[model samples]
Target: MKFFTGFLLSMVFLALASCDSGDDAGVPDKGYRYFPLAVGHYQIYDIVEITYTLRDPDTARYELRVETPDSFLNADGDSTYVVYRSKRLPGEVAWTYLDTWSARRTPEELVVQEENIPYVKLRFPPYNGQVWNGNAYNTGERDDYQLDSLGQGQTRGAQHFDDCLTVLQHDNEDFIVFLDQRKEVYAADIGLVYKETTQLSYCTQPGCLAQQLVEQGVIYKQWLKEYGKAE
Candidate 1:
């Protein structure tokens, strides 16, 4: 009788442990905090763009400020936030309107519409090595975007972020002809901290075929300079 009672108690404990494990597994991770979007939240970034040409490369420097000031329901009845972008040249005091974009978050993914094109920017429960189609809703060709270095600390300029993740949008390089690479980094509470895009066409002439000399293309880099909430 004593042995039977002990066995029964052990079985009950195991069953309860299984139930707890199942409940925990059913709850999805809240990785969307890495790309937080809230009304009145604003971020400023320093932009440096270099356009490569046959002659010397042309460089442009400016500052971009993006803010979320309003939210509205989309056609699907989902809440969408309006992102307003403004730019200011160096030594300027006023910002010039650049453009407007929209972003929405779903249970499984986050979508951003830029220039009327919807892009799946990030998938929920983001983990290292996770890949998804960035142009899933657009008519563009299939583009795989991957996440890496999740929960890592990153330092941008003098600002240091305790937690951050990187999304690699595209990486295609043919050393002899062309190269294309794009990536973005986001902090836990900040939307975007750093973005880089490199597109280059190398000289394929017989004399420069193996030299990998860039003939024309562009390199764009944006770094977060400030972030806060508007009154």
Candidate 2:
């Protein structure tokens, strides 16, 4: 599933690259953004984490309800959503459904757009003079550079914009995600500006989150702890 999605996007991105009209970062947020209102019952309110119950906007209940998964690339690449329920209670359910109006965007769309992409790549801030490409990010390569700063790499970030970095991470099974990260350059060593980390959380099970069977019928999630540095 993931490979198909990426493959389709790569072709689309390749074609779109021909008409690169510079940056279109602050366009989406320019229009009216939607916020979930508690329908008519604006009087009552109880904020819970997205991973929690799906509340009902009308009845103000939170019981026996269907829920929509609100995932995002914040630390992990997933879905994002707005809870909708005409009524609520402990047992009320949230009626979750598929949302259309999809997008074919690069990671740079986070700041340019208005999505909540966490800025975790800023561990290494820029030092002296240079242009910081806050999109050319890498994985686990935090030590050699500077702690949190956009650490320097062997490659030049001159062309690492939008989702261009994905070209470097293409078809790799070990790589689960790639987010547009903020970057800057020091005297010689480059520093990080900010990165909207696209975290991929999954379980190693037959039908678990992003599970796949590498051998036989046994399914598994390709994951590893980020405790070491990137070689």
Candidate 1 lDDT (Cα, 0 to 1): 0.92
TM-score for predicted model 1 compared with the true structure: 0.85
Candidate 1 weakest lDDT stretch, 10 residues = 21-30
lDDT for each candidate structure: 0.92, 0.26
Give one digit per residue, the lDDT tens place, for model 2 in 1-231.
999999999999987885675565333431111111121211112222122112321222232121222324444453333322233445445433322221112332212111332222221122223223333332333322222322233222222212111111111233222212212221121111112122222334556434421221111111111111112
Candidate 2 runs further than 4 Å off: 1-153, 156-231
For candidate 1, the clash count comes to 0
TM-score of each predicted structure versus truth: 0.85, 0.16
Evaluated at residue 114, the lDDT of candidate 1 is 93
- Per-residue lDDT for 49 in model 2? 17
